[model samples]
Target: MANQSSRYPILCASFNQDNSGFAISTKDGFKIIDSNTGRLCYDRAVGAFIIVEMLYSSSLLAIVGAGEQPSLSPRRLCLFNTTTGAPLREMTFLTSILAVRLNRKRLVVVLQEKTYIYDSNSLSMLDTIDTVPNLKGLCAFSPSLEGCFLALPASTAKGAVLVYNVMELQLHCEIDAHRSPLAAIALSSNGKYIATASEQGTIIRVHLVSEATKSYSFRRGTCPSTIFSLSFAPSLQLPDILVATSSSGSVHIFSLGFETNQRTKMSGSFLGSILPYSVNDALDPAHHHVLHNAVSAGVRSYAVVRKVDKVADSSSSEIASCRSVLGCVLASELYLFIYFCVPFYLPYLYVRLPCPLPPFFYLLTSARS
Candidate 1:
């Protein structure tokens, strides 16, 4: 049945750091699309490539034809100018490229059992590190232009995420995130937080890279579902807000807040004697808080979904049935709203959408800012 559905390998696609641009690759070809104007920045039906990624926040793109085409070997990687679709530089690898990630200063290429870091400009090799069997190509990069955080699997641990300082080439904190395979990994725009999900894709944990503290946890859904992506949106006034997209067709946004100054209390004094502080406060293992039955501020998440049914008309466009959702997460409460369409559009489509919705704190912001 699955073979009857798709004739070609599914196209690998991804968006840039700020969602301004996106890249898509299939055996048919490759193209970069602008998100704001809904236009193709560049299109190429040249090869049976399988991977396409944009250099963070830039128009530069990288494409890899690992195993999709045999005429071109699996090691060839091409960097192209998205504005003109001109090949800037091309390089070959010792093995197939499992995954490719780009920041402003560096490009990371992941193989099956090794990872390569390269200077984005010169495309020169910076360093190489061995890894455990990472078949899914699990990796993450901080969203900032000065991206220094790179999280990958540990070589010895079964399910540990090792954070590395790319510039210093030194090991940072390591989080024993899960015991099973990881479904997705994401780093905040400011590189202060890293969110991870296991293969179950139900529970997600956000950790402080410097302290390895589990600051926030989110349960995406009731039953197990495939997590499509996990992202940290930037905001000016928010603490930690994360967005997780899943195969369930819902975007789950989670916000986390902590008791301010708890860790930095000026040694409380009662009678000239100072209050006792725990020795393990810095790297204290967070009390395991699973998604189920966990308390959250205000509303947890709002989901936008397409109202389609088994008996729905096949000719109807899926976009015609999509409904947008709104949610607000306060310091102590979570509010969720699911409605039909926007105001003026109700006359045309009868949808109850928020025409100009108020800001819900800073669900999107750099952790550093």
Candidate 2:
């Protein structure tokens, strides 16, 4: 019998400080690969356990995971020097880490119901926030780092979303979002929009900070099964692009836009979907039945970043060229019996590009004054 529940490999990956390269956690160990060359720069065995989650802070890399055997001991979170793969610090807790993120100044870790903030330099716990209400999923922090937002399902009702302010540790607002639990949440690079996916595989969008007095919502698309993840484009030219991976090994993308009157609104224009060839199908033609299991169990992850370069302006060819570039990244993997049988696999797909244009530029152009 085929398993109805969808399961994809959850890889742990981090972007380099320059956003030029990426480090991915694999079954054998960890590897640092060149983004352009696709060549392995470094590969070493960390241990026998599969990494659960990872975060990059400056030159530091942190990984969290439990041992091969399932026990009551908490997952071990280890910090390492990315350049040499040297262990820096290791912390253990009874609760497993659900999410991990790093900003310029701090490393934030979200466990089951609590959030831990740590100093980027010392790796010491700076503060712990305990009162977050039923944190369903966490999204990227705002560009200013003033606050982080979370998606919470309505406790009493069916379709509801509760947005929380991480800094203030308060409920900012609530939206009657979807009929099912949220699968993933993503914040726009500009921090002006928020996108969410539900268990039923519906994508919805909302305005982060409003300029008008009204609120708005938009539908991105529906998935064949539950959506496991969501991401937005890093380029400023793109408002927000939504991506969702389904149980049937299909990936979908949506171009998102906003509509506003007195309230803000969201609309998801369907972009397209991709169904890549299964690895087993390419490797072994004799074992076709196994190919279905391989693809169905394979875990897929997606991320986007912007690449900018000066291009000659068509209207003013004599003048210096202006900036023009496009960015994208998408990857998937199947963890069959390959050398190692690590308990949990963490696969991450990351795209790195130059820093985007400042927010003030957009604000100035959109301002009414």
Candidate 3:
């Protein structure tokens, strides 16, 4: 049973084993909501901190975020038992955290300039990789559980991605990617395609470990919006790309497809855009005005909810089931906006929408009416 209150936005959400319930991180803390009861069975405040990124194993949850202070210091990592919101272990580091990923065997953490690998069983540090030039981002193990890859955005003269063999800590392949620092990196579940985006909205798709080399680009228009995040849906049945733009508070979804048995392409019209659904939309003018003003000034964050079954359908259909549903909600001031405020205001706020407005003549008739 899904939560009955469709009006409230979900801060963070993840599925459970039976696929019957979810562990949701909200402004309050963490809560386990029974899908059948639509009631929270467990809830607790892990800390006064906000969740920057979260990963879950079969019954464990790993959350990483900044400390309670405003500084460049590294964030703390906490592991919790999904069934009970109980803290299992906690660890601290030195540099700010960039990403966190938990595989079946190990937990990987990417800091300001280094990568740390840990033993998944004891949450103990197993080894560290600090030789890489500049570690920009981290992609956890694929859905197939083959291995994980590390993305190096920094190159002496060129931009490239360094694929690392997770178990051996050995460099696998270095491919010339882009001319500028990579803004986002993602790998398809099958490990067939690798996509990277830069400051500009230009997306580059490359065939991974293929000798018959081929690549393509998807122009996302002249929206000066930086791609802050990229993720490939973890479902093997429905392989799609999810891109988080710095501009509007929306997550863009694209279906991955292969053309002519060679090049890869991102197709399907604009899936669906998530926006803050104001709660005061139907309230009285005076009261609504106040609520609207408060909401506008408050921090807003959007989360994209993609049902695993939806992705599964794409594998069996020819036309590609492009049906996408969007869920939006407000986030606490600390997590959603504090750290990203400057970037969001300076670059994202001015991004132009993809659609064009009607001509002046078309507007005249509406004005007369």
Candidate 4:
């Protein structure tokens, strides 16, 4: 489909799990490229493609086409061999395919309000899921492909994240993440955690299913900024990182780790009041205040240490550096403003800085915002 130079062309894209290569689909065909060398690995003028995805095993690529009634139809879902431009499997369905996600174990196809999971090799239907109305066809496969997760709007409540375990066909948990519709959803590399952003895009909340704790909340900005993507930094080392890119032209990187200080703030008292203090942990005056902030904060990160844009503009023109504030307030009506709306400064300086910091030592600074 040669653009007559007037109409803009649209492309659908995705990267492989290992980040070795990426795949893109256009009206012309599907293409795969080596991410490292910028070399085209495979290209096929199969038909007009609407979506493309790669398997974690790097053995197959799945794509959805608009229609090739003569060769391939718009309803046909095709999986091709990555090494060779050979069609491995092709299936035609009745409805328009909204999205397709695959791992080493299974391939999931998303329809308007329904999802189907099939064996990658046999292409046999393993399970089918019913979603809320008008889901953006958003779903994710586990890191190991042992399970799957879907965040759908709650049938009863608006702006609720209905977490579903796609394998067992059960509801795992639900969180009232925001007042606005969800803009993006992400799963951690290990598949034990989930992160979500509201359509407003001012807040990011990470949910932990396996741990005793449930959620860690972070404020992305004072106002809404369109979030492009969120990802866990590839590492098996200390200080796990979660990076977020936005239309604001800033890349926010968060340094994450489990801290005993988080649990230091106790949940109980003589009258069961909302009082949090570091009783069990050492009370070094240096990291003392962080304990109060850690009562509800599970994932800890050093705040960005840059100038924040004070002028609220509908357009985000430049990038700003700001510290990642660590704060937690208990699940009570009294602390809602302190925990979620207001951003607190980091109590301690990150020993190893990931971003450039101000010349002044932030060690002794407090209440200076």
Model 1, 81-198: lDDT tens digits are 8677688988888988878888778888888898888888788898898878887788888746554788987743445798987777777878888776677788876788898988
TM-score of each: 0.67, 0.60, 0.58, 0.64
Clashes of each: 19, 18, 4, 12
Candidate 4: Cα lDDT at 44: 80
Q: Rate the local accuracy (lDDT) of all candidates.
A: 0.58, 0.44, 0.44, 0.52
Tell me the spans in candidate 1 whose CA falls farther than 4 Å from its real position: 1-10, 145-147, 155-158, 257-369
lDDT of 2 by residue, 54-123 (tens): 3322346666653543431236667767676677877777676666666556666767667777766777
Model 2 regions lying over 4 Å from their true place: 1-21, 48-57, 69-74, 124-127, 130-171, 209-224, 257-299, 305-332, 335-369
Please identify which of the two predictions, 3 or 4, would achieve the higher TM-score against the true structure: 4
lDDT digits (tens) for residues 228-281 of candidate 4: 556553434333445454555444544344222233333343422343332222
Query: Between 2 and 4, whose lDDT is larger?
Result: 4
Candidate 2, TM-score vs. the true structure?
0.60
Candidate with best lDDT? 1
RMSD of 4: 13.9
Best-to-worst ranking by lDDT: 1, 4, 3, 2
